[model samples]
Target: MSLPVPIDLHVRSYGRVRESDRHAYAQLVLPLDGAVALEIEGRERMLDPLQAAFIAPGATHSQYAEGLNRSFIVDVAPATLDPVVGDRLHERRFAPVGPEARKLVEFMRLLVERGAATPALVAGWAPLLLDTLALDAARPLSRLDALLARVEADPGAPWTAESMARCAGLSPSRLHALFREEHDTTPRAWLLQLRLARVCAWLGAAELPIAELALRAGFSDQSALTRAMRRSLGTTPAEFRRRRRT
Candidate 1:
C-alpha cells in the first residue's frame, strides 16, 4: 500500500471522546502530553507520552484518547519514507519520542506555520526527520538522501537510471535493484514523480505560463506536462492554478 506524502504538519487538542477519527493521505500521531489507545489493523495499542503511531494513506483507524489533551499529526508522503522505512505501512506500533523525534516535531511545526514561501523549495527538515526515524529502526537506505538531493537540485534535468546511479556511485543495474527494494518503483518513474511534485508547487504558487512551466519542469511540451499532471495530481495545470488563486 502506498503512503500519503506529508506536505505539512497539524497539531490539535481535543477533549475526551469515544472516538477521534480522521482520514488523510498520510499521517503520524504523536502524543505529547497524555496516553491514548489507537485501533489500527483491528488491534488496539496504548500510546503513552512521546509515543507515536503511523497511519498509511487512507488507513482506516480510530483513536480513543483517555484523558488525552494534545496530539501532533505530521503528514508525509509514501515516497518520503518508503525508501527508508520499507513497504510495510503499519510497522512497529511504538516509536519513542527520542530527542531526534522531539526535535523533528518542533521543526515540522515551524515549517507548517510558515509554509513554503518559494516554489520547488520543500522543507528539507521533514525528510531528514524521516531519515532519522529510519536510522533508528536500523533499515537505513544510504543512497536516499543523496538521490533526493540530486533530484531537488534540478528536477528539470533529464534524468535516467544511469544518471541517478552515477549520482549514488552505483551501477545502473544496481541502482534499479535497490530502488525496487526500497521504493517499489523504477528510478525513472520516481524521478517523474519528483518533477511533477515540483510542478504542482509551482502551479500552486505562481500563474506561470503553461508552456514555460512545462519547459521548466523538463517536459517536452505543455501537453506532456498536462497529461502527467492529470495522472499524478488529478487535475489539469489550468485547474490547479485556478484553485490556488482562490
Candidate 2:
C-alpha cells in the first residue's frame, strides 16, 4: 500500500503575487521555463528552468516571475513526510539551488509525467530530497516574515517606504536597508510586484469586472490595468481567462 499524497495541486498559468498574498507553503517549485525570483529565508535567488526551490512550510517567502514562467509546484505538508525528514526540513535555512537538488526536480517531473501515482508511493521514491536540501539552506527565517505579512495583508494599498516603515514600526531608512539586505530589492519595487500579483489573483479567482479589479488592485483605470498587465504578465485579462479555461 502507498502513502497518500500530501499536496493540494493547483496550476497557475500567467500571474504574479499580490502584496497582500504572502502565504508560503511547504513545497518544491520547479520552473519548466522562464525564470522566478524569490526571497527565501533572507537570501534572494533567481530560479531558471534548470533550477528548483524548496520553501519550508510556514516560512515567509515571496516569489516574482517574469514573462510566461511555466512551472510545476509540489506542495508538501509536514504531516505528510516522515518525522526525520519533516524535522530536518522545518529547521533548515533558506538556500540557493544545487545540482543534486536539480536531480530531484527532474525525478519529480518524470514521476509526475509517467502516470498519476499515489502520493505515498511518490513520497517513498523521493524520501530524502527535502532533508538533504535542508542541510544546505542558509537560515534567514525571521527577517522576511513581517514585511511579507504586511504585503499579504494589503497588496492594493498605496504602500510607500515611509508608510510601510510606519506600519512595521521602523524608519523608512531602516525599512529600505532591511528590505535590500533580505530580498535584494527595494521596498517600492516589492510593492509594485505585489500589486501585479493581486491583479493576477483577482483575475484568476473572482468574477468581478475588469474595472473593479483594476481599481481594487490600485490601477487608476482600465487602460492602466491593461498596460501594466501586458508589461508584467504578457497577457490580457480575456486571454488569460480563455487559456485558463482550456
lDDT per model vs. reference: 0.64, 0.61
> Which candidate number has the best lDDT?
1
RMSD list, candidates in order: 14.9, 13.4
TM-score of each: 0.47, 0.48
Report the C-alpha lDDT of model 2 over 113-136, residue by residue, as the tens digit: 434445665656455556555644
Give residue 220's lDDT in candidate 2 (0 to 100): 80
Clashes of each: 7, 12
Q: lDDT score of model 1? A: 0.64
TM-score of 2: 0.48
> What RMSD value applies to candidate 2?
13.4
